[model samples]
Target chain A: MRILLTSVFVDDQAKALHFYTEVLGFVKKHDVPVGEKDRWLTVVSPEEPGGTELLLEPLGHPAARTYRDALVEDGIPLAQFTVDDVWAEYERLRGLGVRFTQEPLEAGPVTTAVLDDTCGNLIQIATQPE
Target chain B: MADDLFKALADPTRRTIIDELAEQSGQTLFEICSRLSMKHRLGISRQAVSQHLAVLEAAGLVETRREGRYKFHDLNTAPLRLIVERWLVPRTSEPEENTP
Candidate 1:
């Protein structure tokens, strides 16, 4: 009845695992080998380790590349993740050499910033008013 | 298959159409067009709506059936539910002794 998992297609699983876990601060929840070259890798936010999982699914299909490329070219974020503090998280990520497509911007009740996930995805970090 | 499903859903217009269908399932092309325009305030053409529906049908998010001259489109939420069950469903019943 609730959202349990969502996925963002990645070009490389190893690089994505490092960025998502080490830099983005999520914890590896699952990493089961699916085939010879791919794994069912997933990560969850540290704050909600038992909550929703983000699957770092492989971008193996030809259409996936085109879809990701189009979204990136149009400057649309691939996914949005909620954070407690947008500016602080943006600063910390920037310090880690993560390239941002959009700086922190406050719009109405939410503040948001978009950064490249380094795996063919532009991820957005946001903070909503309580 | 999942990639194509996601790709089909990636479009805003297509998402809106899906929303419209969710609101009222088993709608014909004309009914979908009218509802989209009146309810959602989307002034998209019939051809555009048809194309989006085609994509949704291909993704298995929608199914179509012909009743005489009219083709009715129904929302198929099975694929979406399958995705959730595949990764989200907790395997609490299974032993977790292998955890590292």
Candidate 2:
């Protein structure tokens, strides 16, 4: 299936906007208004065209609270996404002051790196598809 | 929630059900069954469909709303989107709402 958009819950929109665009190299797509201060914010990859879209969702829903909390407790990534070169992304992200909880580790043909998004969750960067 | 989502998606029948829901926008259980009747493509029973819906709901991948005597099931894009965002979308800045 063609993956369209992915989303994550953010505590603050302003911080998320900067981190995604300035630090990570993702370009802003839409910051449509949802409701008083609520937005349907989204972003897209710079290299890939009409490829992956990132949705900046607001957290406060009980369901998200539980899901995110459970992920944090279990020490399991909520999910993993593929990249062209995990190490390069890792180094690049590191240069920008991104703090990673785990350094890049190789497992079989795949290599992975993880970092704290500073939003109570850990993000995994994988070089190979799992 | 990820487990629930993965479990719900593990079955081909459940995936079919979800695919149908996606195409039709949301569907009542009764309507869902009705559409599946003519096709022998389904591998499971109606009861199984209910169970799948339950799992999906728990995963935050699908939601059910009560309307009159029937319950309408709609796909929740949160988990799917979150899964995609974490991998495909790069961190622009530190994600804002960090709830401890």
Candidate 3:
């Protein structure tokens, strides 16, 4: 079996769609209305449009909210995404008014940076070691 | 399955437990608790570890068997492999040589 989808709980689906697609450069892959206010929304990396999808699931469950808040409070990233260049990505994201909890740092062979997704999640962007 | 797996992995403690099981599978609850405390310095109770294992088992990331009086847990990495093959492997392969 293959992983068709994974999800990151978001506070608002519409806000998440805007930030993930418009700012983060992912393409909207699916958006089907699921409930009265929430939809089965998902996005894919621009570079791999047909690849695995990241579902922007609603944070309506009480457990989800608690889990997300605890991670954010502890300064831990909820999810990590690989980038071609962490520094360049950091600069580009900062230019777009994105708030970063940690700036780009080279540790060992890889470089990484963490930024708030503005949807109750801290997402990490990293570059694989050469 | 995806939701359950992700939720299981969401907690750092559960992740660490999985890491331990990955390093050496077929460990009993007592062994797991001891390893967590000795190696990871996590002083979580045996009851707590059992609950975490239950979550992991429900996620299809862990399998358990009862042998006599001992219940042994083993890591089922199939789910994680599916994730890596689906998204990570493809994205990391043949990246543009120079893109800024």
Better of 1 and 2 by lDDT: 1
Backbone clash count for every predicted candidate, in the order shown: 0, 16, 0
What are the models' TM-scores?
0.57, 0.52, 0.57
Give the per-residue Cα lDDT of candidate 3 at B43: 76
Candidates' lDDT values, in order?
0.80, 0.68, 0.80
Residue-by-residue lDDT tens digits, candidate 1, A1-130: 8999999999899999999999999999999999899999999988888999999999999999998876665346778899999999999999999977556755446777777898988787889677
lDDT per residue as tens, model 2, A1-130? 8878888887777788888789877799888898798889888878775788888788869888787866544234544667888889898989989966445655446676666566655677777645
The deviation in Å at residue A8 for candidate 1 is 0.4
Deviation in Å, model 2, residue A116 alpha carbon: 1.2
Question: Would candidate 3 be rated incorrect, acceptable, medium or high by CAPRI criteria?
Answer: incorrect
Model 3: lDDT of residue A48: 91
TM-score of 3: 0.57
lDDT of 3 at B19: 84
User: Ten consecutive residues with minimal summed lDDT in candidate 3 chain A?
Assistant: A101-110
